[model samples]
Target: MTRSTITGTAPPEAGATDPGRTTAAVPRTGRLTPWLVLALVVLAGSAVLALTIGPANITAAEVLGSTRYHVLTWLAEHGLGFLDPGENPLSRIRDAIVWEGRAPRLFTAAAVGAGLALSGAVMQAITRNPLADPYLLGVSSGAALGAVAVLLLGFTLALPLAAFIGALAALGATLALAGIGGRLTPSRTILAGIAVAQGASALVSFAIVASAQGDSYREIINWLLGSVAGASWSSVAIAVGALVLIGTVLLASARTLDAFTFGDTAAASLGVHVTRTRWLLLTITALLVGAMVAVSGSIGFIGLVVPHVVRLLLGARHARLLPVAALVGAVFLLWADTGARTFFAPSEVPVGILTAAIGAPVFAWLLLRTRGQS
Candidate 1:
């Protein structure tokens, strides 16, 4: 299939404002702008709303007040003490609830969600396969294996570092296997990743079954299921740092991704250096995924679902799809995580469980819709 066949828009002329934007498809920018604005507004509102939730009855006013006071204090500590915003605006308990309890987790969720969704969109484009996602390369399973090893062995090592190392190792193995016979095609990459994932998952299961004990067992289980309840200021730093650093590169490659939509041959013809671009993008994506899974263990479906939903509404233009999908994914997971913590009152379920439950039915609907189109 060609670019026109898949996107229903012809290739661009050399001097087009965006090489990915064809004149025939340019009109949707007007429609896409409002959705982008709405997604930004909703994401901001959701972040504030998430802070006010939980067993505590903190109001939005308290959330905002605590946020302002802390922001000023942070600035003062960084050599701007002249700009002090007075004494603590709220009681220490209330400030702790906003700053220590919910704020970091909220930022972590948004960062991880945005990273995963952006990676998924890029993966799908590079592979020219709608089923590709952040985990399609075995990063999650590898991270889980590493985390389980740390927990079961009673190691004092940092869990995120171990998980990140495992994810990189898995990516290396998958790429090596995919390149064994000849060129690294998407089909070969996918199959190699599946094999690696299964191997890592088996090891993780064995470690849990054979060595897990008491509290460690529960800790392993929670990490595998994904929860941001343990998120701290460090978690926010790690997650947001990775998102800003790698996610920017992915976003800047939007036109390249658009070139990739048709296939390697089409992309190469359009001056995209298909082979090099594919490998580089895959490696970059793996790094981003590794970082996210290290912080929030193997959260699923936001990547798979959000990009497609955005494309359905905003067209397949990568420039629009990537950012909008990021914002929407952040909002989606924020609410989902909030519900996971609050829905059962005293008992806190894993956020991954909630995501899978919601994502499964939505995925089924998307699948059926695709089949019907065929």
Candidate 2:
């Protein structure tokens, strides 16, 4: 293939007949803004509605009230008593359920969703691989290994720390392997990641089979399957912090990602430092994914499916694609987790299972659609 074909762009002399050939074409920002606003509104409404869901009998009004009550209480405690809304309206149980249980879990879900989706979008663009997700680098398996090891060792408190460390280690290893023979290319990176993932999976299986017992076994299973059922304020803080800080960097690289879709040589010709940019973006994505997986284990599909769905609606330009994808992803996972919380009633299903169940069919549909379009 010529450079034009490889880069998905046609030379002027070749004729501009294939309008859809170029991947870097920017769409009108005005057309995309409404989608962004609608996604934001939907995400906010979904979060509140999700809070009101579950076995607990709570309403949207009550959820809002609880949120207001907490804000006021915090303000009062911080010596801004004048801003306090007097009197606690809800009973202790309701407050605890909303504040202590559901609120953190819901926020964590949203944050993780946003982060994963952002990571997946960047990954797909950077590698020019549509099937890539946050876990394509073996980060998720490594995290599971660390978390599982801790659970078996009776160090459940250190699960998040261990998981994050393991994810970083896996990232390091994958990069090292990918760079060993020559310049790190997308295909090499992917192969190395698969190798690391398989090795980590093997270790995790052995550890679980040999050591896990009783509640530890169940805990290991739950975590591996991914759940925010035990999410606390701390989980919310980590997930949201990672999303905001790292996510900003990723979003800022929108134009860089757009250039990437045009192939390395094309991007280089456009004055992008392809190797440096790829390394930087990949490392940043791993850190964000690590923080997310540490808190929520390996929640799948939000990363894989959200971007494709958003791209179908908004097109492939990264500027329009990134933020809107985050919002839609937040809403998607928020509801998936809500279903996980309520669908089985008293026995909560793992959110990961729900995402996979939902993601598989959606992904297949996306593949068929893409094929038809092509």
- What candidate 2 gets wrong by more than 4 Å, as runs, is 1-29, 155-157
Candidate 1 lDDT (Cα, 0 to 1): 0.85
lDDT of 2 by residue, 1-374 (tens): 00111233445654366656754443332456567778889999998998888766888988888778878889888898777576666789988988898889999999989999999999999889999999999999999988987888666567889999989999999999999978878899999999999999999999999998899899889999988888899999999999999999998888899898779999898888998999899999999999999999999888999999888776788887899888888888888899998999888899999999999999999999879867
Mark the regions of model 1 whose C-alpha exceeds 4 Å error after superposition: 1-33, 81-84
TM-score against native, each model = 0.91, 0.91
Error of 2 at 353 (Å): 0.6
Q: Give the CA lDDT, 0 to 100, for residue 158 in model 2.
A: 76
lDDT of 1 by residue, 1-374 (tens): 01211333434543376644434433343545566688889998999999889866888877777677778888888987766667665688877877887888889989998998999999999888898889999999999988887889766679988899889999999999999978888889899999999999999999999999899899889999988878999999999999999988997898899997788888989999887888999999999999999989999888898888888777798888888888888898889888887899778888999988988898888899879766
Candidate 1: worst 10 consecutive residues by lDDT?
A: 1-10
In candidate 1 the C-alpha lDDT for residue 119 amounts to 92
Best by lDDT: 2
